[model samples]
Target: MSYESITLATIAEKTSISRPSIYHYYDKKESVFVDLIIQEYREWGEQMGPLLERRCSQEQF
Candidate 1:
């Protein structure tokens, strides 16, 4: 469900959700984009956290 850097029209078309529904959740397109960016960053951080700790442990050796 990734739609980064895409137009609202494209997102609406892809999700089969209306533009008004999207706005209802996000208030504005920029808010939706920002929320998407934050979600990606959070997911990346979660995925990398363990790997980063492993690297740090190795470096401490």
Candidate 2:
């Protein structure tokens, strides 16, 4: 979601979590965005780990 559109109130409404609870985990909304980026990298690494170890041809790569 766009940064301007993903406010804490909107997130809480969508997730059904309280706004104060969300704040307990993230000091600011930007921190949540940073954590999401980190999580995406970790999940991508998990999915790519085996493929990366294999010797694939350029066509496969």
What would the per-residue lDDT of candidate 1 be over residues 1-61, giving only the tens digit for each residue? 4546676766677889998777668655677678889999999999988787764555663
TM-score for candidate 2: 0.83
Predicted structure 2: lDDT? 0.87
Number of clashes recorded per candidate: 0, 0
Q: Candidate 2: misplaced stretches above 4 Å?
A: none
lDDT scores for all predictions? 0.75, 0.87
Cα misplacement distance, residue 44 of candidate 1 (Å)? 0.5
Off by over 4 Å in 1: 1-10, 56-61
What lDDT tens digits, residue by residue, belong to model 2 across residues 1-61? Answer: 7878788777778889999998789777788878989999999999999998999998997
lDDT of 2 at 58: 86
Assess the local accuracy of residue 47 in candidate 1 as a C-alpha lDDT between 0 and 100.
Answer: 93
Lowest lDDT 10-residue stretch of candidate 2: 3-12
